[model samples]
Target: MRRFFAYLTAFIREDFNLRLYAGTAAFVAAMTAFNYAVDLEDGIIDKHRGEVLRFWLYAGLDAFMYYSVTVFWLLANRQLSILKTARFWLFSLAAIGVLAWWQDYTGYSKVVGLPVFGEIYSFAHYCFSNLSSALTVWVPFAVFYLLVDRQPSHFYGFRPDWLSLKMYGILLLLMVPLIAWASFQPSFLQTYPIYKGWGAARALHWPEWIPAVIFELCYGFDFISTELIFRGFLIIGMMQVVGRGAVLPMVAVYATVHFGKPLGETIGSVFGGYILGVLAYQSRTIWGGIAVHLGVAWLMELGAFLQSFVHSPEK
Candidate 1:
C-alpha cells in the first residue's frame, strides 16, 4: 500500500503542473456533464447502433476529441515539441478512436446470425462480444509494438516482475464496501451482473449458473484489453513522447469511455484511471491494474447477483 502511494506521490512530484491538471480536470468535468446531461452516449450515439459506419464515425470522433484536446492542453502548458513526435500523436489518437468504436460495435451480431446458430446465438454473441476485445485491442497494439515502436522491452507493460498483485489485492479489499454499497443503487443493479443469461441457459437446458459463470469470465477478461490500452499503451507506450504527461490525458479519455455507464461509475473512472496510470508509469507494467479491475468487476457482479437473489420473487 505504501509502495503504491509512493509511486503516485513520486509521479505527482515530477509532473504536477497546476494549470495542466486543473485545466484537464475542468475539461473532463465539462465533457462528462454534457454527455450525461442530454444522455449523449445512450440517447444519441447509441441510437445509431448497428449502423456500422455511422456509429463508428460518431464514437471515433467523440473519443478523438477528448484525447486530442487533453493532449493539446498538455502540449500548450508544457511547451512540448509536437513537431518532433507528430506521427506518434496522430497514430495514438487515431488508434484510440478506432478502438472506442470497436469496443461498442454491434455489427458482430450480423456475423453470428440467429439463422446459423439457432437458439445459441444469444449465448454465442454474448461470449464473443466479451472476448473479442483481446483480438481487437491486443493484436493491433502487438503488431505496432513489433513493427513500429520496436522497443526491446516487454511489450508495453506485460512485464510480470513489475507488478505486485499483493498490493492490488489490498486495494480490492478496500473497495469491497463500496461495491456492496453500489449494489443497492437502482442504477447500479440495472447495469450489473452484466450476464443476462439471455434465455440461452433455458434454451440449452443447462443450469443458469453455467452461462452466468461463462459470461462473467469473458466479461472479466475484457478488462485485460482495457488495461492494455489505457495503462499499458497510453501511459507506458506513449511515455517516450509525453513523459509523465501521458497519465492525465489518459485519465480524461478513460472517463469518457465510461460515459455510457452510470454517472457514479464514470466519475470513479477518473480517479481509478489516474491511480492506475501513475502506477503503470512508475512500474512499467499493467498486471496490478488488471488484478484490481478484474477483482472489482467480479465483486460488483457478485454483489448484484446476491442482491437480486435476495429480492427475487422465487425466494
Candidate 2:
C-alpha cells in the first residue's frame, strides 16, 4: 500500500513536469463548450443520406478538434520551426480532411475492394478507415521525425515493459468493482459497449462472433492508432520539445474525444488520459496503456452484454 501511494505520487514528480495542466483544462473547457454548441455522434456509415451526414459532421468536428489540439501541442513545444510547422499542418490537415470526406461516400467500400473482402466487409472497412486515420498522423510524423526532427529510430511509443505491465494490470483490477457498479446503472449500460450501432452481424446475417471478432480487431487497431497519436506522437515525439507538458495537452485532447460519453466518463477520461500519458512517458511504451484500454473496453462490453441478456433476452 505504501509502495503504491509512492508510485502514484512519484508519477507527478517524475513524469508530470507538464506546466500545461491549465492548458489541458482550458482545452477541455473549450471543447465542452463546442460540444454544447453542436450535436455530436459517433460515426455510423450507411447508404442512407442521414447517416452519411452524421458521419461527416461528427468526424469533421472530431478531426478538427484532434488536429487542432496537435497544433497547439506543437506550438507550445515549439518542436519544429515556423516553416516546418506550417508545412506539417498544411499537409496533415489536408490528408485528414480529404480522407474524412472520402469516407462520406456510399460506394466507398466497393471502390476499396469490399467485393474482395466479401463476408468480412466490416473488417475491411474497419481496416481501411483505421489505417487511413493512423496514416494521417503516422506518415507526416515519420517524415518529420526522420527528416526534420531527426529521430534515431521511428519506434514512437511502442516500447514494451513486461514487469511494469503488472502495475497497469493492477490498475485495471482496481477498476473492476467500479465498472461492475456502473454496469448496473441504466445510463451506463446504454452508453457503453459502444459498438452496438455498427450492427455488422445483423446487417450481414453472419455468425455473431464474426462481428464480435471484427469489432474487437477494430477496437484494438483503433486503440493502437490512438496510443500512437497521444502517447506516442504527442507525448514521446514532443517530449524533447516540451518536456512533461506534452502529456497534459494530450490528456486534454483525449478527454475531448470523450465528449459525447456520459458525464462521469468524460470527466474520468481526463484523469485516465493523464495516467496513460504518464505511463507512456515513464516506460516509453504504449503497450500497458493499450492493454488497459482494450481490457477496460471489453470488460465494459461484457458487463453490458450480461446485463442485457439477463433482463432482455430478446435483445
TM-score leader: 1
lDDT of 1 at 303: 96
Worst 10 residues of 2 by lDDT: 39-48
Residues 280-310, candidate 2, lDDT per residue (tens digit)? 7777777878888878888888889788778
Candidate 1 lDDT over 22-76, as tens digits, reads: 7778778888899989897888877776676555656565566556655665675
Global lDDT of model 1: 0.79
TM-scores for all candidates?
0.90, 0.68
Worst 10 residues of 1 by lDDT: 76-85
User: lDDT of each prediction vs. the true structure?
Assistant: 0.79, 0.64
Q: What is the lDDT of residue 26 in candidate 2?
A: 76
